[model samples]
Target: MNGGNFMSYVIGIDGGGTKTEAVLSDETGQVYARVLAGPSNLNSGSRESIEGTFLKIFSEIKNQQPELFQHIDYCFAGLSGTENHVNKEFIEALFKRLVGGQFPYLIEHDAVNALYSGTFGEPGIVQIAGTGSIGFGIDQHLNKKRVGGWGYLIGDEGSGYAIGRDALQVIFQHYDRNQKETILANLIGKYFEISGDLKDIVPTIYQAESPRNHISALSKVVFEAFDMGDTDAKSILQRAAKDLSKSIEMILEHFPLSNKQVVLVGGLFNRNDVILPMLEHFLNEECELILPKVEPVIGSVIAALQQINQKYIPLQK
Candidate 1:
């Protein structure tokens, strides 16, 4: 129970659509242990699916560093697709079970954590384009005004899901027009393992275990095709980037940060190198680009520190 060991035993978790990433760090932001587990997105999976990931992560950390069981001071879990109270409670209960009710657990939406990580608890616009898309604006008061963060069905306008859906639609339209030379048609055929006609893929996709996972996976194909100079794919990606920029503009128009920091995160930003430049070029007014060197889990840790210590802890790099 010494203070020295406790100083190095804080945990930060980023629960995303694809996976949950955790990092154990020192008080000075030096990472000591890192783990990646399955999706802890309570809204995306079953309760068992969510809790199982949390259990596996806790077990792995317990095995790796037993002292953390006693000395871990704080934990922050930021989950994707979190909007309602039900989603919040599900993550909270899972965290309680994971740490055996020890330490402080702060449950947050995924975009807020991106803000914390990207800006280091300062002010900025975090434009996230992953499986979904959202923009968060943080003011000096730490007040947050969010735009987007809706799922694939309604919102997620400039997200991977959006691009993927557009690509799929293109595939179907090409088929309807009997234009079979498009590469996306072949790509769609391979993706759904559908033979003969492209029409069957839609039905097959709906019947799959995780339809979002399938569509999200195809977004990578779209990005890759765009990289290889495919006109159709590039058009879809450009439109997606523009759509994302519009979301950012909406946030800026509403919240208007005097600091003018813009932090871009998520899979789409990582994959399509073109999109970031496109967004920056489109929104070239009073902005400082702050890329996140630390993982979003670090954002969760920053939030946890704020919760326990009531102040922002910038990474001393």
Candidate 2:
């Protein structure tokens, strides 16, 4: 795999709101070493945390495979909170600083990694519902589009933050219109260690910092409610699933996927048991829903290979 003096290995980085993963692979698409680090999503963690995470991952990789790290020729980084120009610029600069500017690299929204995770450089779609949500992909005509993922403060309908916020609204409704009892209040109260009187959750929410990780944390409780057979929890998750499906429909214009497959990647989909059936019900006959064969970081590795190899990565059968 030698190209000149160095080996033909490349690097792929997949950075999400919760954690970051990196992979080392050669031109033949063989993975060498994979490393994990803390959150690099600017939306989920601070800038310092992201810098630390990337540095840690790269350092770990270099330590594990010194020769391969020295020979890396290119890198592809798919990251969250980097869809914007400013954030993208910051990450690109940080990357050049860490890995040196001699190597070729491209920084892209994490959506590309998710999409490529399933499509293998072909045209397809990926619906990502994590701390935030976004439906993104290349359509049948090779048209690229991004549907949502505005952020929790404004939009992001199918996201954990949005779902958790809507679940809390159930309690808000109970206080607002004197609605019926539900298990969410009890479960959420216990999850937060707050009083059984859910109305008293005001101080806990309002007093928290921005981006509202606290609110997003309630999604775990929502899942708990659904397992307990709480009808209200089922309704909330169904609506969230429907919202995600609508995002897919919006991208495909209600058309079937050309590949007839859609990649589902994110922490939200980790609870595929509850969410998968609901998503399948909504996307019914639209596209086959699949979890990634390999994680998105491998997709990043595919992307890095594609940058030089150009559509040569064979679709895994």
Candidate 3:
């Protein structure tokens, strides 16, 4: 789809704390290629790591079809650091340099891509619960509001990190009150590789560079405990669901997405059945409609295409 005059390609990328994915498509919405790589989250990885990952991905794509570079019409990078102005500019500049300023760019928070994914490029709310948690959306009038996602330390209440941390707390409470006879206690000990007294757990988690991983490691515990019919675990999950729903409520009240469709993304949302039911209960009570599923990468692609439209790039080939 190229000539000496140069056919253009549009690219969409979702860069997260654990992985990054890129989709390349031509006009008329024909997908050309898709690529995946290590974490591009600037907060999680150093500048060198982010650049190295991008360079590696670009090199791999170039090896396949070097001409694709010149054809890049526009690129949308929905990366983890998009919320921060400095990080956003840094990534945008880095990309411009890497592509030799050939393509225009739209860099945004990964949440926007998630929200875009849910609404299929329309307007809606998206609740994400990965290593961290955040809820974000834009209304029809272009008004945007977000809840939680204040990083692992302060917020991220319903996130994997939060779930895991709470599970640990549950275990500690059991120890503190001398309660016994539970699988969770044994599981926690094994997961953290703690054999002796559990008092050391707090210090171990605090010392890690990314404490999210510590809490993230216990998300499975939430699921397992629930499966085992542990009332305490069920309570924890219920609380998480409530917290997530509360975020939505906050967004709806403050930003007024009263009648918009709501979509759920992220691994935890997909995997945990408990959350959906709880979330559905709350949303229904509030008169909200829920979509079945939304592949967020598709939203990323749509966002990239919008950028292409902004450049007044004619669709005619």
Candidate 4:
């Protein structure tokens, strides 16, 4: 980590519930290669899938940019569900095999990357609403608090998966009650190519290898429907915003940050027009809600650079 050579570089990895993004950059902020792979969140899928995701990412870097891989002086990975000691240890061991332990390394929860993405390593709150959702905050004193990353079943209320699940719920409820037909059923049916056969949805959804991804992907359709003036779709998003705001409120109520900078990351916030206003409506007016232009992987790069040089700040472009 103390090496002071131009040849030395760093690898920054952002492992989210939906995908893993990695950046290979020099100490001077020169990016040699950028690689993307599947989800690597510890709670995302089975252990095998998570391992395969990292394997694919590391292998791609080593094969595509061998020189960059060899020159990696420090490695930093911001992974979801790593706040637990056991999950942290598991990922660290995996990194040793895939990334090699020769270089100094750090493993942190994905929220750190989100916070850094917006705050540049300063104290702030990050609400990660993707395939799953978690409310994470770092106070002025650097005290960290996390809430509502309980996966799809119990939490992740405002996530893409949750939105998709809500869509599914309304459509199926319409079918069950024999009520006035909703456009959501028609749209979702067409999306999945079920041809209006309600029975077909069960197997098509349940039988998939990754049902969560399939369901979460439906959130896109919900957003589309909202754009098309569908009341149900609009309602679903509104409800999600309420849940997301509640999660943020819980974090702020318990562990308040001096600066109410709430950085929005993940799929739901991507549609700031619909979701951002909803958040503003439910959340406090003073909360400086931010949608960062750069992705979270840039924050991971900052984390990696900080290992060797704290003053060296990488461009978040």
Query: Candidate 3's error at 287, in angstroms?
Result: 5.9
Candidate 2, after superposition: displacement of residue 127 in Å?
1.0
Better of 1 and 3 by TM-score: 3
- Candidate 1: how many backbone clashes? 0
lDDT of 2 by residue, 126-212 (tens): 998887889987766656788898878778888899888988888788768776366887887787687566777778788877536
What would the per-residue lDDT of candidate 4 be over residues 53-105, giving only the tens digit for each residue? 88887788778798667767787899877887877788888878876665778
A best-first ranking of the candidates according to their lDDT comes to 4, 2, 1, 3
Measured by TM-score, how close is model 2 to the native structure? 0.82
TM per candidate: 0.79, 0.82, 0.82, 0.80
- Model 4 gets an lDDT of 0.82
**lDDT measured at residue 262 in model 1 versus the true structure, 0 to 100:** 77
Poorest lDDT segment (10 consecutive residues) of candidate 4: 308-317
- Candidate with the larger lDDT of 1 and 4: 4
Q: TM-score: which is higher, 1 or 4?
A: 4
Model 3, residue 176: C-alpha shift (Å): 2.2
Predictions in order: lDDT: 0.76, 0.81, 0.73, 0.82
List ranges where model 1 is wrong by over 4 Å: 1-9, 17-19, 32-39, 45-73, 93-102, 186-207, 284-286, 308-317
Q: Evaluate model 3: give its lDDT.
A: 0.73
Report the C-alpha lDDT of model 1 over 238-310, residue by residue, as the tens digit. 7887788788778888876788887888788776458767767766475776777677888877777766653
